[model samples]
Target: METTEADGSLREAAGKVQQAAGDLLGDAGVQVSGKARELRAKAQQLYADLASVARESTLERPLTALAIAAGAGFILGLLRAASRQNRD
Candidate 1:
């Protein structure tokens, strides 16, 4: 497994244990904190998975990757400009 996947798994396991402890002790704060940690770990794992896929795709098709990146950048720039106009 990748380092990020391993770390995320460990973090998720810790969160589960914390959540169970909170449930046994009836501590809402601990329960909420554990739940948040679990969610963050899941998100981290998902990001790692997506990054791996993106890396592979980029390697397999560099031109396609460049095009997609350019398109995404253009869209982000437009969104930023729109946000600035709204703020002004």
Candidate 2:
């Protein structure tokens, strides 16, 4: 009886080792972390590019700023209308 119990424990331990190894091989967390790091690098590069472009392009007029503000407001209003339509 004791020998059988010991063998069962060994089998359980072996199963645990295999499970751990399998988990290590196909880990979603590791994949997601790698993807997140890649995305962060891309975003940083894109932000730097945007900053350089901003430094180069001059929208140096009061009318240009007003037009930009009006366009943004119109886009936002359109988004709100779309959402309202979706709910209905």
Best by TM-score: 1
Root-mean-square deviation of every model: 2.7, 19.2
Which ranges of candidate 1 are over 4 A from the true structure? 74-88
Q: How high is the CA lDDT of each candidate model? A: 0.95, 0.61
Candidate 1 clashing pairs, residues 3+ apart or interchain: none
- Writing each residue's lDDT as its tens digit, candidate 2 over 1-88 gives 2443445445545545555555678976655555554455455556666665654553556577578789999999999999999999
Candidate 2 error regions (>4 Å): 1-24, 59-88
If scored against the real structure, what TM-score would every candidate get?
Answer: 0.81, 0.38
Q: How displaced is residue 23 in candidate 2, in Å?
A: 11
Cα lDDT tens digits, model 1, 1-88, are 8999999999999999889889999999999999999989999999999999999999999999999999999999999999999999
Angstrom error of the Cα, residue 6, model 2: value is 58
Query: Model 2: how large is the Cα RMSD against the reference?
Result: 19.2
Q: Could you tell me how far off, in angstroms, the CA of residue 74 lies in candidate 2 after the best superposition?
A: 18
Q: What lDDT does candidate 2 reach at residue 72?
A: 100
